[model samples]
Target chain A: MALQPFTVHRGVAAPLLRINVDTDAIIPSREMKRVSKQGLAAGLFAIWRYTEPGGREPDLNFVLNKPQYRNASILLSGANFGCGSSREHAVWALNEFGIRAIIAPSFGRIFYHNCTRNGILPIELEAAVVHYLAEAIQAAPQQNKLLVDLPNQQVSVAELKFSFTIEATPKRMLVEGLDPIAMTLEMTEQINAFELQHRQRMPWL
Target chain B: MAKTLFEKLWQSHLVEQLDGDAALIYIDRILLHERTGSIALKSLAAADRQVRNPDEVFCVIDHIVDTLPGRGDETMMPSGKEFIQTTRSAAQSAGIHLFDIDHPKQGIVHVVSPEQGIVQPGSTLVCPDSHTCSQGALAALAWGIGSSEAEHALATKTLRINKPQSMRINFEGQLGTGVTAKDMILYLIAQYSAAGSAGTVIEFAGEAVRNLSIEGRLTLCNMAVEFSAFTGLIAADKKTIDYLGGRPYAPSGENWKQAVRYWQSLHSDAGAVFDREITIDCAAIEPMITWGNSPEHSCPITGTVPKIDSANKKSASMQRAQDYMGVKPGQKLAGLPIDGAFIGSCTNSRISDLRTAAEILRGRTVAANVRAICVPGSTPVKHQAEAEGLDKIFIQAGFEWRESGCSMCFYAGGESFGFQQRVATTTNRNFESRQGPQTRSHLASPATVAASALAGQLTDPRTTQKS
Candidate 1:
């Protein structure tokens, strides 16, 4: 299934400034009762977002629970965000919770890939730049909405504008919402050719 | 012009070098578990897609399957039964090999793959679990993938991947007494934070890595994801060849000879270059354990919790981890009381790991207050341990000897440690609430966990061995 193309997204950004914010924290295993990706929004950050385990009561101290950030469509975080686990449910939850993009200094390799495949833009900026944008968003979140321009590869909030870089393939995929499998299937000849030689070279495989 | 082992493997498996570093890589094998595999298979079927090559795909009922003796499809994880049933039907319909719950070969995907000889040198394998990198110890190119990517690999037998830069981590000297592969990796991550190898493929080399047993090498590479690396690899040697010999899926007779000859050439050239290189003196490493929620929060057993400096950028996270663990700065980890000791997971649950722990539990029983459980990585490993009377040692030592699977590696609304329980565990990942709600996990080697269980505290294995 093709994703919703994300060309330009402007939304309220919530700050979750903590380094090594791993995926397990993004969505706990207990919250994943089903095998599908839908319905994970309630489980996003459940450990911190909820007052108790498997409870619906919100933890008022949690940033996402705050009124200003309740409908947060963007997340601003520290380095190595989504650092552990290869579960794409982390990305699925963020996408379901209306998160269009995430700004961080760095990300877990697999989670970064998962973001692109899920129609969520993961922008890597300097820690200082991310902190600056986060501060700007936190001061007056309603007025200081973040505008993510995928075509230009720039993030703008308030008077600050920062340019980011993304790979050509992922950029095209995000902008076009192209199904990667269908695209790869177009090159069936090349894959078949490689497999034929691979089988002959190492019949054991 | 020398080429690194990564470059050799990359080129060999490269279906097409796309724009920039992006390439279409052929996937030789796809391993799956019930927890995440069900979603991928269900999604693929929903999209009306068929598996390109079912012969190369293998599925196992590891994750979410209860590890209790005489276990069936019912799991402690709610609705976990659906995942198993979905994967069972999907795998059977797709005509792929399915190692069901009662299959003698059933085990964690990573453990079962290598033990079954499904992973081989120069092959590229992908799984939906992060510990898939464990198989790279055999000189294979394996890495973790998301469920969608699993579906893509299932439908096309290929994936669009951006080639990662290469890095080589060299453990130069021999490991000291009580120091094992688990300690070496923990020490490495502690020295250079968890994101030390971000965006790079690490080839663990040097004397220490080569000296490690195949199981030890697997333990070392298993935590590559925790290091934030794309994957980890080690050159195949005589040890790797001998370990794979006579395995069910390995090449036989003439094919075995050809495979061996080719695998011998899977190492990096003498003067090959890497984007980055780091060397560690293995002799300096001691039995290491984590004090906080991250793998990077590790220290030697004799070390103290680090003081939080307001000026340090990581102080906030450090403080949060400390507060959650209920430990203060300057507090020593040794002799700290523990509520539980668990020995299982893809990280360290093989026969060798079990034997290492059994040596410590031979005569001594677990502390009267501590709850200790040992889950074998695979049924075969469990049988081997029983054959050697290692299970008797574990049982006699007051530890629960359970069935084979990924039990309690992470909580999934299943049987979990009590609230606020602090555990000494051999599994990877010390993330918040990983074991249970508000549970504190101290990651360490099987020896260290065994020692902690015996003493009911965080005791160094070396000290226990002396006594």
Candidate 2:
């Protein structure tokens, strides 16, 4: 479960202004046939990415279809992004689609955790700041490239800058590229202490 | 300090706080399904990790298991048998209880949890599937976790999670005919949009929720994930007590009395504070159905597609949904011809749901042009429906009555509706390609699905009188 350490990410930011952008939209159930996270890059935003007649061809109007956004490595999203399903594949799809970070006002709680676990930095900023980033991207597409600094926990669009906050554990995990399982088991003594007491009182559970 | 029902559950389950709002919480029970659990179990084995407490964990062959009657180790999904076989072997090696395909109790994870009484009030449960929150209807704290979190909980008996904010939705008045808990939840999601409950644990309160049957409550809570909520729950009450009484996994004798007393206290205090609150009148609800991809794209069955205007904040999503569903603003959802109808899912495949649909389908025949199918939520539910002749009623109505599992609700290379077919179904999600690629899924209650099949269109069930 070791994820690639995230130090600094700088790339063109694609703007998706919709709120409550669900994981199902990121990657739908039909594309979940492969248990592993393989071949998910094509399924990213499949609904919007695919043209109607069986989705054989890409939809030209989609942001990713546009030449400028073809290399988008960062996503600027509205509030409550990644809002449904606990599928970690949503993060996998985004990673495989070349998105290294997401800047949003807020995020679905589980999706936020999943993103952090998978080394996809989900920077939570104010709604106004997110809007500024989206507008900045729209104003000068090529000049709108942004940088996400995981160690410092900050995101910047040229001179415009916004600092972000993530917990110490996830921050360290991202910096160290270590899965939390081994670290989580560090408190087994406390965990075992509670379980033994709980089992005695509620054996049926 | 007065505590919300959710707070009490969280406080009792707290093992250690990691940092800030994040805490290492003990999971009393862990339920796993073939899709996600197999991956976790295989990973656990690969890592040389053993389940911390095998007796407290259980796994079922749902999600990837074919619902076809004669289905065994074979799966409709190519290479899907590996998931089932891997899970079976992993569960055996881990010493975790396995509800195999032929296990009498084998069923959808959510349905099996409640039916087997594995979810008790005041307990904290986690499953790798989103609808695990359905068990919260029993007054327990249950929510979905990813495969990685499942592996962590299996190995350490605890998970590191940041506590969610709290919301309480109060419903007053009485429900009208054709209005069920499914309609109530759909109405909530529609009114507030799917993200309304995001990052919050929801407590469904007020007279309307209290009056619902245990099955109805489960049906309502089952869709908690649809609203982007952490989970949904109700306070333990007499109905919950009665439902859990005498089940195979429930405590007996003096332990049972003590358990009941403890559950009785697992409710919100009078002055418990909630971060958000919403009020709804139950009598105002109507049979609901989704007209488009997202569950938020739902309306009363009698209404037309919303005219997306400046007033609608979700105008962009609505427009996309309209195009994806091939509907225009002000388009009527009713009388729209459908090529298929599906009645089943963790959301609404319980015995009561089956009986409710059967009452409408008795002696009725599905339209020749529409293909309809019914899947019970669990093997026990299937058996109970057959005992009551519901299977016969469905067969007579030309609806295929299939074995219990998560079938057709999600197409992970299993049986599916016609490609790009418009199907009216009783399922939790209507995301594009959820049932099949290019498929247009209109979500509704089981009765609506059954009625739509008979008319070969998305007909409102309230219009059709019971047989």
- For model 1, how does the per-residue alpha-carbon lDDT over B242-293 read when each residue is reduced to its tens digit? 9999999999999999999999999999999999999999878999999999
The global Cα lDDT (0 to 1) of model 2 is 0.86
What DockQ was computed for model 2? 0.51
Model 2, residue B196: distance off in Å is 0.3
* Residue B156's lDDT in candidate 1: 97
State which docking tier applies to candidate 2.
medium
Clash tally, candidates in order = 0, 0
- Considering just chain B, what TM-score does every model have? 0.99, 0.98
**Candidate number with greatest lDDT:** 1
lDDT by residue for model 1 over A83-181, one digit each (tens)? 888899999999998999999999998899899998999999989998899888887887789999999999998688999998898899999998999
| Total residue pair clashes for candidate 2 | 0
